[model samples]
Structure formats: structure tokens, C-alpha cells
Target: MWSGAAHVVDAMEKWPSSQEPTQTAYGLAHGTDLTFFEHLAGNETKAKHFSDSMTFMQSAPELRHDFVHEYDWSRHARGTVVDVGGSKGAIALKLAENYPNMKIIVQDRAEIITHGPRYANTNIEFQAHDLFTPQPVKGADVYFLRWILHDWPAR
Candidate 1:
């Protein structure tokens, strides 16, 4: 316990000492002090780390069944679809392969898109873009945003 003149402790010491905690501090400590969404939004390194962590998590069998079967690419013809936040061009490359006649634009953050070894296929094009702002590409028959919206909130 901290000795003081009956709740008249100095302004600096009125709060609990940082090293340990009183009951109130202990109770509050159990709750999260930081907003998880805000933290993830601001921390680019954390976002990239998380994205990379999920890199190998995609399985071919799963992609074939879940993604390929889920959509009918034949509906759209003779145009490009921009893949927003299309990291490493995985989905874009797959779409390009499936829809050989259609061009695929894989857009992602400058940090992710600027590095070496982007997609080599002529059908796929890579551009540095930030999704927080308005999209750059236009007039596409389709705009793909696979697994990207949830990264930020709906609002």
C-alpha cells in the first residue's frame, strides 16, 4: 500500500507505480489496452509478416476445388481484371492461366510490389498501388479483391 494523506498523494504518485499494480490496475490489465484493428492497420511490418505467414497455407487441391469451381470465368470475355492487393500474383496468375484470353492486373502496396521477381507471364501485369485510396485501374470487366477487404473494416 502507498502511504499518503488519505487520497491526497502527489499528482505523479496518485497513479499506481508502474512496476506492480494495485487491485484497480490489476483488473484493468486483464483487458486489452490497445485496439487490435488499429494496431494492425498502422503496422505495415506486422501486416506483411501476417501476409507472408499465410503464403504456403494455400493448397493446390483446395484452390482447384474452392476457387476454380466457385466462379465461372467464361462469363467475362476479352478484357482484364485487376486484382487488388494481389500479393506475389498467386490468384492473378491462376486466373490468367484459367482465362488465357483475359489480362490480369495484380496491384499491391509499393513495398510488396516493388521487390524482385514479380509475375513473369505476359498476361499478368504488376503495379504498385495502395487500396486505402481509390483504385487506379478502370474499365475492367471484373475487379478482383480476393481475401483483401477483411484486412480493413467495412467502414
Candidate 2:
């Protein structure tokens, strides 16, 4: 996390007058044309570490509790919950455990999708998807996009 924070700092320092620093900091730190995740996709160890980090963040009890209490799941009884950019389906699994009537779909990049099945059960399903594209699962009762959009700056 510290390294990521450092990267954010570095990116902020390099932020252009009229543009965000994602591409610049990414290129500076990685010396590649690819974005951070794009670079990680080709490396197994880094990819695993990234996924583990996301899982660690999601495993926090208070975070889960806040989400559970804040959202009115009862209103969407027997509905489908699509967890977009869900790293390893951890939150979705938790939701499934609590809301037995609701079905959960965890979607993320292909690199993270492979690890999803390990955490999935009958009530939770995992799909490989890039959130930049149009959502494939139409008419979901809820599309939960937790901590996802900040990765990209508004164009």
C-alpha cells in the first residue's frame, strides 16, 4: 500500500496543468506504455499480490458492516447484485451469506477473474469483464461499484 501511495504522490506531482497524471506516472514508474493493471496482467506474481491487496481491504469487518447497513437490500428481494470491479468476490460472498434470496455476480478484469471461482459459491458467480466497456449483465437490481472509478480521471 505504501508503494501505491508513493505512486499516487509521484503522479500528483507530475499532474499536467490540464490533465491527470495516470499515464505519465504510470509510464515513469513502469517505463511502459501500459497502465498499471495492464503491466501487472503480464506478470503472475505482481498480479497475485494486487489481487491479495484488494482482498485484504475487503476483508475488513467494519467496511462490510457499513455496506450491509447502509444499503437497503430488502427492497430488492430475490434480485441480482452485480459487483462491478469486485476483485475476488469477497464482498459478494458476504452479501450472499447474509442475503440468501439475492444472487451475486462479481465482475473484474480477466487477471482477477480466475481467482473469483475459488471464493464463489452457488449464490455467487464471477465473470471476467472490463468496466470501461458497456456492462454486459443488463437490468441488474443493483450494480455495486465500490472503489473503482477513482482509477481513472474524468476525460
Candidate 3:
């Protein structure tokens, strides 16, 4: 996180004269063309650390409570909710625990999906999906994209 923040600092320093104001911080930090996840993907340790960090963040009670109360999930009680990029299905599990009638599908990358069955609740299904491609599960009630967009450079 600190490294990413430092990258933001570096990116800001270069931002003033640049044509693209929202250039990626990771690109500036590493002086490379690869994005942050692309770099992490090539490094096993960093990828594991990143996954662990996300798990830690999702475990926070305040974050879970905010997610639960902020949305009107009752409207989709009988519908399917596809949580796109939902790593480990933490939010989906919480929603399943709260609403028995709703079916939640947590979709993430193949690496994450391999371990999904072990961690995910029985009520919450896990699927391997790349968010950049078209959504496989069609006509779902909600396609939740929680904390996913910030990874890319702003357009």
C-alpha cells in the first residue's frame, strides 16, 4: 500500500506537465509499462501478499456493516447477484448469511477461484471469470463491482 502511495506521489510530481493527468501511478513508480497486477502476477510472493491484504481488508466489521446497510438487498431477494471481481466472496458470503432467499455468485480470476470453494459459504457460489470480458452469467439482478475500478488508470 505504501509503495502504491509512493507511486501516487511520484505520479503527481510528473502530472503537471503531462498530457494525461490520470496516468497510472504503478507505471510511474516502477518506470515500466506493466500495470501493478501484471507485476504482481509475475511475482508469487507479492501476489500472495496482495491476496492476503485484500482478505484482511474485507474482514473489517465496519466495512461489512457499511456494505450491508448501504444497499437495499431486499429488492433482489429472489434474484441472483453476480459479484464481479469479488475475491474470496467475503461480501457475497455476508449477503448470503443475511438474506437466505438471495443467490450470490462471486466471480474472480482463475487463481482465486481455485480456492473459492474452500472459503465460500455453501449458499454463495464461486466462479472463475475475467471482468474485462463480457459477463458469463446473464440477466442477473445485480452485477456488483466493489472496489474493482481503482486498479486501472482513470479515463
Question: Model 3 segments beyond 4 Å from truth?
Answer: 14-31, 61-65, 115-117
CA lDDT scores, all candidates in order: 0.60, 0.77, 0.75
* Candidate 2 TM-score versus the reference: 0.83
Task: Pick the TM-score winner.
Answer: 2
Ranking by lDDT: 2, 3, 1
lDDT of 3 by residue, 1-155 (tens): 45657677667776654444236576666666666666766766666677667777877766545677788999998899999988877788778878888989889877766654454335688888888798899999999998898665455
Q: Is candidate 1 or candidate 3 better by lDDT?
A: 3
Q: With candidate 3 superimposed using the best TM-score fit, by how many Å does residue 47's alpha carbon deviate from the native?
A: 2.0
lDDT of 2 by residue, 1-155 (tens): 34455465666666645254335555566666677788778987788888888778776766545677687888766999999998887788778878888988899999889854565345888899999899999999999999888777677
Clashing pairs in 1: none
Ranking by TM-score: 2, 3, 1
Give me the overall lDDT of model 1. Answer: 0.60
Clashes of each: 0, 0, 0
Candidate with best lDDT: 2
lDDT of 2: 0.77
Model 1 lDDT tens row, 1-155: 02222333432354544322222222233332333323334557755654564454454456433565588877764687888877767677667777788888888766566551365555888898877788778788888887776544344
